[model samples]
Target: MKNVLTYACMILMLTSSFMVNAQLPSKEKQYLLDFNKSTHGEQWQNKWNLQEDPSTWYGVEIKDGHVTALKLYRNNLKGSIPDGISILSELKTLNLAFNTIDGELPEDIFLLATLTSLKLEMNKLKGSLPQDYSKMTNLEELSMFNNLLQGEIPNGIGDISNLKTLNLSSNYLEGSLPKSIEKLHKLERLELFGNKLAGAIEVDLGRLVNLKELILSYNQFQGDLPSSMATLSNLEFVQLQGNDFRSLNSLLRLQSSKLAVFDSDDEFLNMKFGANEANRTRLVDTKYEDTKRN
Candidate 1:
């Protein structure tokens, strides 16, 4: 009887040890470890103790023995993101904003099919956005503002059907706004302010029925505003200042009762409003000199 009891106690100890140590799959854990080492994890604000279980690591979320999220925003991560990040196949969110992470984005990152939100804003990242977004269909919010990215917005961006907020503001991105952007029927905020993007607003703006804020200030965009813009009933804020637009007459037919702010160059038209109009909406017809970021 004494021998049997001792053996039972040993079995319980081993079971508990396995439960504690076998939290993550070996491959995923190794990928995480590699990421940590490459990013100088030791210098992070909340450094991870490599000796401990990965479940206890900072900004890492594990579920069903798979890495599901990694949010290390403003944590002092100072290195370029390592390759093989797509190995975290179950990852849904990857937030590395406000870091010193530089270099062209790893090509593998666009392969994260399950990623819903990817926030890499306020970093030193440079290079053009990927041309193929077919694999990233599940992305809802792709915020990469305040970076050094250049080149035209990819036409393949329309492949992200689930996208809601597309903020690429405060970058060095140039060229005309892609017509494919009109396909984002779910997009709410389309901020492209403080860039060098030129050409007329050719796309049917009315197609984006859910859009609320359309900020295109401080760009090189010229020509008349698209007439379809008058049909955007959901628009609340519109900034078209600091451009070479030929006329603002197209906006006279705007039907949005929710239009709270409308800013444009006053030289194009003498926009006068009644006291009642002034109380309902704030219209600023002046040149915007400073870079506005949101």
Candidate 2:
């Protein structure tokens, strides 16, 4: 009789384990649930509500109960993001640009550890930003330009050491850029144009070893650029027009190798230094007349 009771107990335990495993949703499905609170997201809540007819959703891709991607570009979405959208443990991409969504972005979004791309631009978002922004360490692309965002840019953002492309232009953000940015050693493209930012653009910006496009035009920056050792030896071009650049005479001819354009303006454009040379004179012309391009 003791043997019989032991066997029954083992069977019960095995059955319980199986049930728990079956109930756990796959990593992808959790992602679908994470960003489903946005305007069009509501239509994707129930799989049965969607599986029967897939076209109703602006865009959604799921496999094995996991959401792999979501694209709602130019959808005219409205309303606040629901906290539940943070459950997308396997979600990789999210694009909800060109809409009228208002209010602060949900802080819980930082819980998405696997997210790589995020585009929330051209909206009405406003807030200080969530502390968990560092949790998105795997992020490769981030764009939130043309929004009503405000307050300090999160300093811990440098914790995302693998970031490649970043665009935070056209916002109400103010304050000095975090010194931590020098740690994004793998960044390729960075754009922070059109904001109310002040203070010296961090001189360490030249440390991004792989950076190609560095556009920081249209702001209140003051002071000459630091002559620190540069990390962007491979830089394709740099745009520094429409600011309070103090010393252009020193920077215009620093590298005979010639940056696509180490641009500066007429007030400080030293014609005498390179006035006799054709290429050198062209830099002055480009610096002034070509300011619109960079």
TM-score of each: 0.84, 0.72
Pairs of colliding residues, candidate 1: none
Q: For each predicted model, how many residue pairs clash, with residues at least 3 apart or on different chains?
A: 0, 6
Error of 1 at 288 (Å): 18
Q: For residues 56-111, write the lDDT of model 1, one tens digit per residue.
A: 89898887668899988888998788888989998999988878888889899999
lDDT per prediction?
A: 0.83, 0.64
TM-score of 1: 0.84
Worst 10 residues of 2 by lDDT: 285-294
Candidate that scores best on lDDT = 1
